[model samples]
Target: MSKFDDLPEARRRGLEKMEEVYGFDMSDGEGDFFRYTADHLFGDIWQRPGLSDRDRRLLLIGLLAGQGAADVLGIQVPAAHANGELDDDALREIVVFLSHYAGWPNGARLNSIVEETIAKARRS
Candidate 1:
């Protein structure tokens, strides 16, 4: 059976987008949480109802910025791109949103990650 056979349509769409467009091959390259991220974060958890993919991306921006996770923000940035929830202007808007709670310093860090990720995604 296909991994998606019983899954919700949103999750199936998310998995396909990750594989075909974003080109992430899920694996335990970093061990532990990285593997958990690929499997649970994207695979299982995000499939839950109530929150749309757009809201997921927005929450990602908030949680990442709140935690000062600049490095992972690059990874999450591409997720919105893959899911069609983001564009250049939308990314800027996300940083603006984060600035309210996460502060300018956090927003700047998140923006730096977004910029780097945007450039890399455009290139590759």
Candidate 2:
């Protein structure tokens, strides 16, 4: 079956938000990775019934921050914003809140990345 076959609604929204923020194009050569992300990450994981999308985004922010995954976090920040999962204040607060557990350097770096992402989003 195709990756999209029986795709859950939450997964579809997640992919749409990812594309909107990251300029993702499934037609691009990175089909395998994209399909894995869509089929497994979003389709299965995001479809789990407990958390709301906002809750998922908040958890993602913390996890990405702790992992020092600034590049991915950069993409996620805007995606959360576009999805109405996070606002500017909430984004800044996440940096502050995560700084204690994720370390100052990671938080500082993410703060800068988040600012840049927000600026770019506004420009477009």
How well is each residue in 96-124 modelled by candidate 1, as lDDT tens digits?
88888898999999888777767877898
Clashes of each: 0, 0
Question: CA shift at 76, candidate 2, in angstroms?
Answer: 0.7
Q: Model 1: residues >4 Å from true position, as ranges? A: 1-23, 28-43, 121-124
Give the top-scoring candidate (lDDT).
2
lDDT of 2 by residue, 24-64 (tens): 54422246777677656765677679987788878888999
Give all TM-scores, in the order shown: 0.66, 0.73
Q: Provide the overall lDDT of each model, using Cα atoms, as 2-decimal numbers.
A: 0.71, 0.74
- Candidate 1 shows a clash count of 0
Candidate 2, residue 84: Cα displacement in angstroms equals 1.6
- The CA lDDT at 18 in model 2 is 50
Worst 10 residues of 2 by lDDT: 21-30
